[model samples]
Target: MGKIESLDFIELGNHPEKLVASSKQDLYTLCYPSEKMPVPSHYADFVRNDTVMLNNFRSFVAHRPFHWAWFLRLLKIRGLDESFLEVPGELSYSLQNPCIVAIPHFGLHMLVPHVLGHFIRQDSMVLATGNEEGEGVQDSIEKILPNDRTRFLKLPDRWILRKLMRGYQSSHYPVIYPDVTSSGDKRFRHLSFLETSIRVPLGVENLSRLCKCPVLPVAMTYHDDCYRLHLGPTLVYKEEGSIIFPLFSWIEELVHLYPDQWFGWNFLHEMIGEAKLLR
Candidate 1:
């Protein structure tokens, strides 16, 4: 008879803790003022060409009277104030707790912070990443975060971020640019490698799966007056073929359905490849 077999499990990655360590450097971890992001190559190129367009789009959003009014309402509403927001799914299932929300790019730029502030009251810490140049925006968030619940994480600095994540035990909702665009720019031709390669990193995905946390497919659009935060459906991976795949499929559908609001002046074009305009 063979000696009583001792069980040993082989992990996927070469260095499992290293996987943990690397994952620790999330976009949200560092305090704004102190964090520093080393600029990635081609980042400046992307910014140089798109600065004017982005600014114009941002102004368009800012100038909207409805946006202003909605923002004012957001300030007055509490985290649990679903009445003020146009929540789409069932209250029993939709972001009623701490969960990861995959918000589209354009709506995320301005409106997300308000959403974060609202949710933090219920102990949900909204996470975002920024470059060294946008430290001011990070600083502004830090100032507004509630002393009891709200917090901001700057992603550039790795060491500090690792410690922070370990201490806080937060979830990752990586903000990624959708691969569809309106512009014809070919700069992002190579982006297919970056785009579909993986939006949610393996480390982050594994963490969420292991923790049994739900992923809320989110997309917001400022249409007419109110800023609509659309919560599609909650995805929980119970087994091998869980709802994650269907959730991603629906996300792509939303992107196509609201291309204009989602893209906002070809930002998605630069980030991902250009969109094929409908004839």
Candidate 2:
């Protein structure tokens, strides 16, 4: 945990279109998951090299099984913390003040707040799914985290979670991902990601309003043999609606830069209604 650096891992930023050529094997394991697909002529370079494919796969938070998740879980149970931490000085201050860190479900994201827990004095909690009356999701994630510091709420059950937010003597940073669309609830806001309007949950946005704090879009990925953190613009809450465009754009950029690390690309089209249309 020291001075972190910008992503210098791959050349994806210079030529984002190369993803159309990702290796079939790599795409099968990393992005496409379920079955092997014919790689287009253009995307082959994205996952052609064995080293590049595996390295990018290791950077993601979710895994097919034993590859990424189990290894990290073993490390956590053995008391091994993150390889590093990086956030702007002012961003740390915003954490101290009431603020929401809207993390997208990209890369090794679940561990960010857990890593921050070691450095910051303030209490922190990860807001996950509140199903099973907030018990099921909490159990699954809390087991992997450094401590039992996760909360489960339907997220729309705003008043109860709001009270907990108010009680934070210091900032009890509640981390939540807004890009999920596994559910068909109309409560989820519509957002554009890669020319697709996807259903995104507005839990973080509502929580920010309840706490009257600004939202910062944050992302984490392991690369160059270390952890790399990415920060998007801080959005002040507004009555009009959720500040999702900027955050969605940021994730879109990261997804382009690290296409293999984002697991949702398969179901992403479905979430955006593109899959159904094709049918």
Per-structure clash totals for the candidates? 3, 6
Error of 2 at 252 (Å): 1.4
lDDT of 1 by residue, 1-279 (tens): 111111111110122222223221221222132112122223223344355533433444344323432343344334335554575546334544555544445454434644644443254555544444334444533333233233444445444334333423654333322233221222222212212522222222333465566656666666544566766666676764354355556655665565334443333333443442211
> lDDT of each model, Cα atoms only?
0.40, 0.51
TM-score of each: 0.50, 0.61
Q: Write the per-residue lDDT of candidate 2 for residues 149-202, one digit (tens) a residue.
A: 545555444364454466343456556666763223346677766665677766
For candidate 2, the TM-score is 0.61
Span of 10 residues, lowest total lDDT, candidate 1: 4-13
Q: Tell me, by TM-score, which candidate is best.
A: 2
Q: Candidate 2: misplaced stretches above 4 Å? A: 1-91, 123-148, 152-170, 181-185, 239-242, 274-279
Candidate 2 positional error at 165, Å: 4.8
Q: Name the 10 consecutive residues with the lowest summed lDDT in model 2.
A: 1-10
